[model samples]
Target: MDSSPDMGLFGPESVTWKVHSEPIVTMGGLRSLYLQALHPRAVAAIAQNSGYKSDPWGRFNRTSEYVGTVLYGSTDEVERIASRIRRMHSRMTATDPRTGERFRIDEPELLRWVHVAEVESFLSTARRAGLKLTDAEVDTYYTEQLKAAELVGLDPATVPGTAAEVAAYYERMRPQLGITREAAETALFLTVPPLPDFWGNRALRLSLNFGPARWAYFGVAGTAVALLPPWARKMYGGLGLPTTDLSADLSVRGMRLLLAGLLAAAPEQYKMAPMRRAALERAGLA
Candidate 1:
């Protein structure tokens, strides 16, 4: 038995597709992680249940695959993947660090937080990276992502479905969020993921450890932190002045141009994410 949609939840015309296609969107993924970690129960659920400390890249790879699948897989495949996530989270539990209250990871509130953070990060990062979406298109992107919220058991009405709503939602959620010890550790882990051991070669690992590759990845991480809302940055103890947003926008533009040149120069060699690449081929735009 097999299930594959000739098309996924979105297509070439979608703002979702446009934003997700940019090579620099991975920076937004990192940004979303930091934003999500600001929630106490959200990060607590992650800290108690995730193998991120032991296998950060593996965790990152799985997350990337899930996002790609959700955005590009057929309708049935989307249901399959979402169901698997629902079941896994349903069984996990985390204790609130502040209240000592135990809560299920799949609670609707937590799922909504994660979804909103991803949406905001991806859209904002894409724009900052020079995607040029109009104000109406930004609202459309948010509305389109309601499909994503539904797949995860959230009531679409409860999730933000416009740029204005997203801003309001963040304002409401602000009172509930703050820095936690777990969030600080997660931030450190993200900035410096366990790399060389995962790559596995004596001399090659050393090259990676002290190499331009490591520093370059860190550079992206720095940019991701800069993309966070100013208040979120303050909660993380702040990294820059008011001009940091302007500098980060410039950095993203340069990074996007560099990546585009690299991809064009070596189209056959560049390893785009598998599901993303397949979706592009399916849409006849690869």
Candidate 2:
């Protein structure tokens, strides 16, 4: 890839506009991120509610039951259902933990990972479910995602190209992305709350920091996930905790909103192998 541009992976395009303009198969890119980044525990809850047994990959990996049919189904049908999910979630908004400000569901940074994760998930879970998507199809999905990652501030080289590779990368990077009480509170408040059936003492603390408002929202569930050490966090990353570029801006609430957007947008490329390879092709970052 070219090293001339310093805009990270983006090529001088606005992410919000790009998302709207892009021919993303389902729900454009933002919806993809929501599905990709939906917490594993939350996914597990949904799975249990639906009576689907989650694999070792946890809740987000349960897409074999939902996204699978779409990818393999008629193109028109896939587009219709995907569009509905987006329309419903479009009104869904979340708060910035640091600033208490509200933001839309499809923020810029979030859109990038969403685009990437969906492509990844499509390839990974589909294959696992015994469907065979050609390399050409997988590659086509990946090349499009590389553009999205660049727009979001990640170096194309930094993004993995394949679902399997991305999964491995996450396993490798997991230790550094440790989950602390502070991290948990920040992560939880930044996104929407999990279903009521999923909330508990442990889930409460893992959902937010210790405070009146936090307690009111999370109660004890956050505390449970918070009790987990770095190892557990490492496991969480594999289980669908996001691994994406986060903004470093501290004073602005919007930047924190961007972080929420990013986390909410994770699981870049649902299937890791193709996505990781494509990410490497972008900048040889692999």
lDDT of model 2 at position 204: 79
The residue-by-residue lDDT of candidate 2 on 1-286, one tens digit each, is 8444232233223222122122222221222333333333322222223322223224344343234323222334445555665565465565543345666554544443445555554343233223335665455446556644543345677666654555675466443333333334434432334333344576575654454655543522322222222244344453222321011111122322443466556785632334223323443353
Total clashing pairs for each candidate: 0, 51
* Model 1: how far residue 203 lies from native, Å: 4.9
Q: State the C-alpha lDDT per candidate.
A: 0.89, 0.39
- Tell me each candidate's TM-score: 0.93, 0.32
TM-score of 2: 0.32
Per-prediction RMSD in angstroms?
A: 2.6, 18.1
Model 1: how far residue 270 lies from native, Å: 3.0
Question: Would you list the clashing residue pairs of candidate 1?
Answer: none
| Top candidate when judged by TM-score against the true structure | 1
